[model samples]
Target chain A: MSNVLANILGASPVMPLEKHIDVACRCAEQLAPLFAAANRGDWGAAEKAAADIEALEHEADDLKKEIRLHLPKSLFMPVPRQDLLELLLVQDRIANRARDIAGLVMIRRIQMPASIADDFLDFVDRVIDAAKQARKSVRELDELFTAGFRGAEVDLVAGMIEELDRIETDTDARQFELGKALFEIEATLNPVDAVFLHRVIELTGDVADMAERVGRRLELLLSD
Target chain B: MEAQIVYIGLAAAFGLFMAWGIGANDVANAMATSVGSKALTIKQAILVAAVFEFLGAVLAGGAVTSTIRKGIVDADLLSGSPELLVYGMLASLLAAGTWLLIASHRGWPVSTTHSIVGAIVGFAAVGIGMEAVKWDQVGTIVASWVVSPLTAGFIAFLLYQSVLWLVLQHEDPLARAKRWVPVYIFFAAFTITLVTILKGLKHVGLEISVRDSYLLAVAIATGIAAVGAYFIRQIEPDPKAEKEQHFHTVERVFGVLMVITACSMAFAHGSNDVANAIGPLAAVVSVAHTGAVSAQSALPLWVLMLGGMGIVIGLASFGRHVIATVGRKITQLTPSRGFAAELAAATTIVIASGTGLPVSTTHTLVGAVLGVGLARGIEAIDLRVVARVFVSWVVTIPAGAILAILFFFVFKSVLP
Candidate 1:
């Protein structure tokens, strides 16, 4: 039977948006394994990690596109449709950065200098943590929508975004320290190796930057 | 006398057809939220709808029936020739049923209330004269068509906002829900019961004073609340589920409340909508039995029972599938949100019924859902569909009018 009431409730993008961030987070999570395998000189395992990140990134891209397709302009949502699309774009980039960093490290077979190896790995973990934090924050989209982006739910998501900003800031500091360490060892290593290592550090740092942007987009939705 | 029997038979048949259409289609909107939210399974929803819809029609449908039977048409003008009233009522029923069939086939968002009202006005104004149609009463009904939805929407917005403030937004939402859900239950139950006792029971031969009505409504509501609280206390929080979605157990608490609202929704729908089917039949029966258009005659109890029986039969035969399909499509309306819309719509429609206004239940519900959406409760609503509903609202009246005018002319020429 043709039911106006059923048809009136367009497909909700909240759960799908939540699931999209989940996939993006999973893609960024592979970075931890890629670095761990690389530090042990296990090229085979590192290649597998890179491939896994690539696959997850592709999954995230598909989900992002599907969400966009369903979220037509005709939908009347609590938040602006454009705001949600922007949030989706920032979320997708987390996976994009993860894949990019993995590709750069794998193709160049770049090895960290012994002095900065531990510090660099710690830096990678911190950046991954930022993406995880973004995921944690985005996961609250359902609750945020439920509360109409006001009152206690807004405060709760604000706290999450605050913690995400702190993680991103810590990643920035780690990136600065790693850059300085690499600068000191430039003459000892091959010139090309030194340049590519710096590029990888910058690209790895961009993951945290993108994760922080996800928080920014979500914050825009929280406002009246 | 033989022709009188013919007129009554034709009127009853057309009336049953109209009631069947309502049960087959409109009832789905009334019960879908409960099933969609998993607050009541399909079987339970059907049972609740059948029982409560019948009660609403037999006990509370009198006022709107009177409005439809005598309020729209100027029966005084047709008192000298009562056959004209019978033919007009019969023609209006046929026009509405035919229009509903065509509209449903084409998947248009048409309201049965709009169709019947339009057909009645069409036949009276065109077949008789403009003065034969009560323009002031028609104006009031048309105004109500616009006003009811807005009122339901406003109530829904406030109700959902209260839910957010008093329960969902609290840090310990589960505890707050347990503490406050029964109070909401009491309110929902109280409003529907109070209105029915004060306005509906009079036709059923029970003249409850205003003071006693309040006492009775409160007693019934309190008992329902106590039972609801017992159910809420039984729901233990699943820590595993709560870790993923914080409101897991809290929604369960709301589910108990949704069941109560669903019943009210069905009752309200029956109270208002059953009149669309039986009002014309009542007019035809009264005219045929008296051989005069006597507006003062009481509506036969059997006619109300017939309308109720026809609706239940329609539900058993067809509405169950419609309910299932609609329920599956609207799973986005979880118990917490569904209850708000249902309660708001039920309150608005029940009050309208008490006031003898026949408002569209679907339109009222659509308004309530929009109200919740305004409060940011629903995830998404298709504005395009809403626009289409508005378009149909304006179109159905004219369409029903034109069809009714045609049928009136044919009945005038053919019927004795």
Candidate 2:
């Protein structure tokens, strides 16, 4: 009956935001299997993983759009709507970067160098860990809102963001090492293959970078 | 005598219609919070609302009914022509009931209290004379319309903030919730019980001194809280659900608190809103029975009973669908937050009912919800709906007044 009390409550974005990050992290997760398949020189398995990544990336995009559409200008929330919109953008990028990495590998048919394969897969796994950690951090959003973005909940999320930062730093270090290893064998590899491999490493590292930015966006909400 | 019977019959029918409308629409807002929070199922919410709303109307609805019956209009001015008073009240009831039906159909957020008060003020000042209205009492009623919501908001803010600090923010929130929820339960029960004792019991012909009222309230509240604690203790944490949502078990504990608040909310709604349904009927009944405007006569218990029964009938017939609709839409209000809003609004309304002030229960509730939003407890609140509520608040008075004026002239010529 057009109840005023019911209308006064705008749809809550907390659960949806949590769900979006979960999808983004799962998309980033697909990179691990995609890279592993490529490292084993199994083109068919790698393509399947790439397709999975593509599907999840599309899902994340849809979720992001849905969250934005619900978050109209009239909504009064505890955190700034701008900050949440920014956070959603950064979270979506994890899936976007995962898709980009898989797209590049599939287009170039880049075979892993024998010397760098083991280290490269490790780097990929660590980057995915960063995305997972970012999910863990953003998962605290509902609790943070419940606590009014204060007290022990803030500290708990702060601790999570700190761990997220550490994982990102670890991804950075691994990316540096993978770059150095790729350079030593660049001459033996085709010149174009060598260049694209470095590009892929950089793109892979951007996953963690986007994940780190999720933490930063959440931090902005925390500070406010 | 035949004309008096006609007036009484018309007034009863109109009052029952008004009461039924309130039961159908207004009761939903009072019960939706509990249903939305999952603290009470729809069936349970209805049953609870039925019982408590009836009790509230019968036991605590007198003061506000008296205010609406005689406080708003200056009865002395109409002593010469008591039939005019009957015509005006009959018109006010019809006007308010008609306005509510129109507003409900249009899906506008209008208050029954505002409409009735507006209707009474309209007929008295216009149909009779400008000085025939009790402007000071009207002023107080208008002031309470503003003050009740703000007061409820402030209380809700504080209550939710305390919940955050005491329970949700703790290192072990489940343990904290278990330990502290009963105390909150005690407060909720205490405030409602105390207010009802102080203000409502006298209407039932039972008066307790202030000292004994406090002691009796404390005792009753303690028993309710003890029963609440036992239920809270029985809630076992679902480890799997807890992994998915950390507050799962804690909210279950707050579920017990929400149920208590829900009852208070029903009681509060019945106490104040029954007056809107029955106030005019009481006026017409008195005038028709005595054939004189006598301020000294006591209010008959049957009028309150008739109002209570009308509301229950309304709830049975139409409130079911409205409650389900509202409950589905407000899923964001978990028990912890819903209790704060309900408790604050219930306390404010019961207090207003005690003081004989006719405040809008829906507006007070909107205020409480905004208070929760202010404390950062709610995830999202639409300021647009809130703005619309204010607009309707300002517009309802004139809409009801114009309608009442039309009905007043119609009744003057048609009625013997």
Instruction: Tell me the TM-score of chain B in each candidate.
Output: 0.99, 0.99
DockQ of each: 0.66, 0.73
**How would you encode candidate 1's per-residue C-alpha lDDT over A1-224 as one tens digit per residue?**
66899889998898899999999999988988898898789999999999999999999999998998888889999889999999999999999999888988899997788899999989989988999999999988887877678777788899999999999999999999999999998999999999999998999899999999999999999887
What is the C-alpha lDDT profile of model 2 across A1-224, one tens digit per residue? 58898889988889999999999999999998898898888999999999999999999999999999999999999888988999999999999999999999899887679898888889889999999999998988888888788877788889899999999999999999889988998889889888999999999999999999999999998896
For residues B15-66, write the lDDT of model 1, one tens digit per residue: 9999999999999999999998899998999999999999898778999999
Docking outcome class, model 2: medium
Residue B104 of model 1, lDDT score: 92
> Using DockQ as the measure, which candidate wins?
2
Q: Residue B62 of model 2: what lDDT?
A: 89
TM-score of chain B of 1: 0.99
The sequence of per-residue lDDT tens digits that candidate 2 reaches over residues B1-416 is 99999999999999999999999999999999899888999899989999999988877888999999999889998899999999999999999999999998988899999999999999998999999999989999999999999999999999999999899888888889999999999999999999999999999999899999999999999999999999999999988776433588999999999999999999999999999989999999999999899887888878888898899899989998899999999987889999999999999999999999999999999999999999988999999999999999999999899999999999999999
lDDT, candidate 2, equals 0.93
